[model samples]
Target: MTLPVDLETDAARLRAIMAEDLAVRGVLDDPAWRAAVEAVPRHRFAPGFYLPGEERDGLGLTVWQPVTAALDPGRWLAAAYSDTTLITQFDGDEPDWEHPAERHGGAPTSSSTLPSLVVRMWADADVREGHTVLEIGTGTGYSTALACERLGSAGVTSVDVDPYRLERAASSLHGCGYAPTLAVADGVYGYWPEAPFDRIVAACSFRAVPPALVAQTRPGGKILLTLSGWLYGYARVLLTVSGDGTAEGCLLGGTVSFMSARTHAAPAFGNPAHWAAELPGEARDARHGPERITAATEEAFHLRFLVQSAVPGAQLATVGDVVHLVDVVSGSAATLTPDCEGGWRVREGGPVRLWESVERVVDVYEAAGRPGSESFTLSVHHGGQHLRHPRVPCLPLPSPEGRPGRSRTASGRTGHSSSQLARE
Candidate 1:
């Protein structure tokens, strides 16, 4: 295929814009990263992608518009360099046609993560010359290309579970004039042949850090990944592997949403136990104080992350004003209903009161001062992982004086006004 001169010019222009955006956001301070961002032609890798659209049906599925260079070259080039995640594969399948009249709707199984986020992650990983980096989930090879540019092709090894993705990424990397070692293997196992990697970064989120990844990393090496689960909450963590294979690290300040590791795609929220559990004999009505406490946490992302972290395998769902808590492993279920007068009614079923557990944890989080994920530390041991906070710290709340659209000061410690919480 012959290259179009105008397309190359447009791609360069867009790349510059993306670099500026990232720099303004304070994520692209590294000159080498900026140079790589400008040098690589992103459009070559993402020849076609899906633009997530509205839900076409009531099943909560989103309609995705497929953008191809042939169909609309201008739009395609624009999307290629835009600072947003581009869906590369849907429902684990690639689009069959170059251009289709109708749109498709399904979950995104692969994507080119937003350029800014990718660069931010690279910065967080602290990739440097001579560092042997192993990247998990090389979806479209865009990030892989960046790593190769910064660390040289021989310094990076990229792996993915999908054979098709590996083949496509290998082709893309080659076209861009760089060929990093690409492998088709389960990322959870962490490419054992390339053991003792100096740095490991995962594009996919994990319910817990894979033991194999910890084992493969050199002692004092950095391992960056997101800890996410069924509830869809996330905490970016950077752990330092110990000589014994145990890693301890705290959550990064902000939350990042990434696809769950293929091997750890949590069980369905309706895990059979929720249906088989028996109801408690009598339901208890939570008092006003507890009601307010529970309601306050409903819209707080940090609090939700903390709750999900403490109660592994716990899932939460909300309908109208009521929130449901369930634990499939223990066959426990609980529901909270608001009485519209500052109090909530609680119902318990199964072997345990899941809502009570959630409530107690919420209290502990509150007592700790509602600290964000940054305040919590995770210790991954042999059997399981443990999340702990040294002191009860309050999460940085939205500023009370600030309006809905206004930004706050450096210290992010303002609580949202009562009205804002209610509206949410």
Candidate 2:
């Protein structure tokens, strides 16, 4: 894809403007990072991408239209450098660059993460001179290029599960004059050939910090990631690997997410639960309102996060005045619906009583003064990682900021960036 000279001139100005915009927004403050942001021509990484169109199909899913640099250089360049995530592939693979599509509708599987987030994460990771880094989820290689610019190509190793994306990312990186070690491998298993990295930065989301990642990193190394669940809560945490094979960290505030790692992606379960038969559930008095756990309030994500920890795979939804919880992996489902007496009634089904556990956790959380993520601490071990709040019970666990007409910042592409459910 040959870009015109005018676009090249425009790209430099546009890149500088973007760097300044991030600086004003306070995401890009480091001089080296600023230089990397300014030096890289972003448009070269994403020659085409998908935009969600207004049209909807019979299933009520929005239609996605494709825009190419070849077809529309102005729109392509503006989008690439803008603080918007560009969807590059659909349903693991599509928008075939060779025979690119006119329009399509499916899940977005890969993307070029927006710039502010790209820099924010790198800054947060504390990437410094001579640090050997391993980046999971290569995506469009835009972030890879930035890392290479900050720390030369030989010091970086980036891997992705999608060969299609890696092929394109490799081309873009090499074309941009970067030769970072790129590989096709599952992110959960961090590429073993390059073990003992100083920093393991997972651009993708994982249900838990892969224990193998802990084993591969040198003692005192850091692992940066986002944890996602079936309920779609994404919490970013950074852990310092210890010499004793343990790690500890805390949740970083503000919402940000990424597509679930293909190895850890949520399964498709019809009716929201894995059930043998839809049996009428046992009814009981519901002491708590559904809004306590599922509202858009700041503490709501915390409450939902607690529920996810206790119940594991439970997915939450609502119908009329009723709030539903379903665990496709467990066949447990519960519905909290309003009754005539200005109170809610709980109906639960399946092998395990789902709502009972949720209610209990809410009681524990509310008693602890409804502490949000600030109180949350993430600790990892040879067995696995645990995200726990001091006052809450432990189970297991799981990105940021809004932009105009945008709601997420992807670290790299796996499912959809930041773990909030797109439909929710």
Give me the candidate number with maximum lDDT. Answer: 2
Candidate 2 segments exceeding 4 Å error: 54-59, 98-105, 272-277, 317-323, 338-344, 398-424
**Model 1 per-residue lDDT tens digits across residues 86-161:** 8888768766645544455666789999898889899998889999999999998999999999999998999999
> Relative to the unseen true structure, what is the C-alpha lDDT of residue 220 in candidate 2, on a scale of 0 to 100?
84
lDDT of each: 0.72, 0.77
All candidates' TM-scores? Answer: 0.84, 0.87
True-structure lDDT of candidate 2: 0.77
- 105-136 in candidate 2: lDDT tens per residue? 67778998888888888888888999999999
For every model shown, the clashing-pair count is: 12, 13
Q: What range of 10 consecutive residues in model 2 has the weakest lDDT sum?
A: 399-408
The deviation in Å at residue 255 for candidate 2 is 0.6
